[model samples]
Target: MSSDAELLEASREDAGAFRELYERYALRVQGYHRRRTRSDDAAHDLTAETFAQAWLGRARFRDEAGGSAGPWLFGIARHVLLASVRRGQLERIACERLGLFDRLDCRPAAVEPQTAWLEDLDEDLDRALADLPAGQRDAIRLRVVDDLAYEQVAAALDTTPQAARVRVHRGLGALRTKLNHSTEASR
Candidate 1:
């Protein structure tokens, strides 16, 4: 594979090079969107939008500050997926206003006890995460879920490695506190 710099340089001058770059990053970008959206069709749409935006904005690409174009494309995919989610939420609100759910399939499914407990745990985890400051939450996600190195997380967050470590530690501590409180309340 060509270096990102070389690929970017070629893409700046040639359309074909841009296509190659898109091919290289498209699957990863789609997977990122899929994880965020939980829908394959939406992921495909977001991936297409990402590439379209990238192609249109290729002339403005900067090799210095942004690092590889892959991450930038993934960022675009993330934004697009987020926008889609917001739009869907708004649409649901509008539909509720019009009483559309009266005619829709609204059957409820039975939940198994194990599944219910897992769902409750997931909700608790989400609440705990939301209670954290943005930097702390991001640090935890990047380090634990993304499996990024401390240095990489620090660089992404524009902070020092030590600061990133502290943020992750604090975030985990806050989560543990919430979990303990939740367990006590259940008992």
Candidate 2:
């Protein structure tokens, strides 16, 4: 169990030491990719590509510039994962335009209890959320889901904190109305 700095130093000299570094950081790299990309396979591929890039760029590795190799590797992985997601989005849009997914919506009826519960919740939430205006949805996602502060949300949305607060309030109000209506319908 060598310290990270020691491992990085050794890895700069020895290929075997680099392998040890990879083993140590691979899971973390994968986890970062998983969070960003939301796909295990994509994360695994991006993690592998990240290590490959790190290993190839070892000659350029500056201990001073990067406080930790782990963060450097993660940064590479994040860029790669984001690029992959953008490419995927483009491909999906192309496929949709070409009608590639038209037949896929016809296949259905695989239901597990947990999946069913999650699907129901997702549908309900989607409906509740659909009642919100786009501005309100953006505010809610930035503030609540992304856990950003009001100031941060305001900056991201290019609005004032008061405006962001208003949007979130309206979004929550809409959601509450939808939930009440749903409950009344159920009863």
Candidate 3:
């Protein structure tokens, strides 16, 4: 069993090697997107797009996670999902501008009680994130949301790994405090 780094390197010559990498991570990557989008089809599409980007960009692969490519692949997944979301938002805005939003029978799926609760939790999370300082917020997003390694997070934030870790720790603490307060206040 070759490490992810070895698989990626081998993929440069034998594309089949990349299949091993996909088999290792495809489901996890799709699940990540699924949890974020709450849409199965979108998850599948985003997973495909993420893998396609990885395949095309294989040659440029940097072993940031020692023998693991989890962080790199996840980084791509995050970008793909963000792009998809941005496109969705822009389309909604365009529809609204053209008065098509109201005209369209865009009935959303009926939300289950559990889903409604989850949606509220998501809003609370967004609020907590908004309360963080910029550096801490970005660090937390890279480390927690994107699942990047400390090194990768540090690189993205142009800081040391120790600093990245500290920021994520502090940011998460703040979020927990805020959410706890919100929960208590709601009671």
Candidate 4:
């Protein structure tokens, strides 16, 4: 099996190698987007765009993080997701300016449980997350849940990269403490 680095190198000349890379990563990438977006259609589109961008930039691919191109691909995915959000914001502003806004109440519906353990974990995580301060919460979401780099998280939050790292570190520490407490209490 070709390493992700090897595949990326080959993909410079053979597009079929890129397909292999896509097959290896598409589902994982889609799942990452799905967890953050909570929308299947959006996840699909974001994953497609991530790969398309990856293919276009294959020549520039460098194995910055070991042998896997996972980090590079994810970096592209984050940018694609951010661009999509910016586009959505622009469209919303345009609609508001034109007085063409459709007032869709987009409340989150309850998730149906696939299993008891997963539900319990999710509930515990939600409780832990709710206990975090707003800045910490947002930082954790962007850095952990969305798998963005600290610099990217800083850019999104309009803070310094060190501040972003601090927020994520503190938030994760708090979450771990709370979750451990919760687990012990459960037992």
> Which candidate should be chosen as best, given lDDT against the real structure?
3
**lDDT of every model, 2 decimals:** 0.66, 0.65, 0.75, 0.74
Ordered from best to worst lDDT, the candidate numbers read 3, 4, 1, 2
lDDT per residue (tens digit) for residues 54-111 in model 2: 8887766644212346435644665565555555556666676777766664322131
TM-score of each: 0.47, 0.43, 0.54, 0.54
The residue-by-residue lDDT of candidate 1 on 41-150, one tens digit each, is 76677788888887777776644222356434644665565555555566666767777766554221121111121223246567878898999999988986697988
lDDT of 1 at 184: 51
Alpha carbon lDDT of residue 127, candidate 2?
Answer: 83
Q: Which parts of model 3 have CA positions greater than 4 angstroms off?
A: 95-187
Report the lDDT tens digits of candidate 3 across residue range 10-106. 9999988999999988987787666666777767888999999999999988664446777678668877766665656566667767777556443
Model 2 weakest 10-residue run by lDDT: 109-118
Off by over 4 Å in 2: 1-6, 65-67, 87-187
Tens-digit per-residue lDDT, 17-80, candidate 4 = 9999999889777876675576687778889999999988999885533457765676687677
Cα-lDDT of candidate 2: 0.65
Clash-forming residue pairs, model 2: none
Candidate 4, which ten residues in sequence have the lowest lDDT sum?
108-117
Model 2, C-alpha of 23: deviation from truth (Å): 1.5
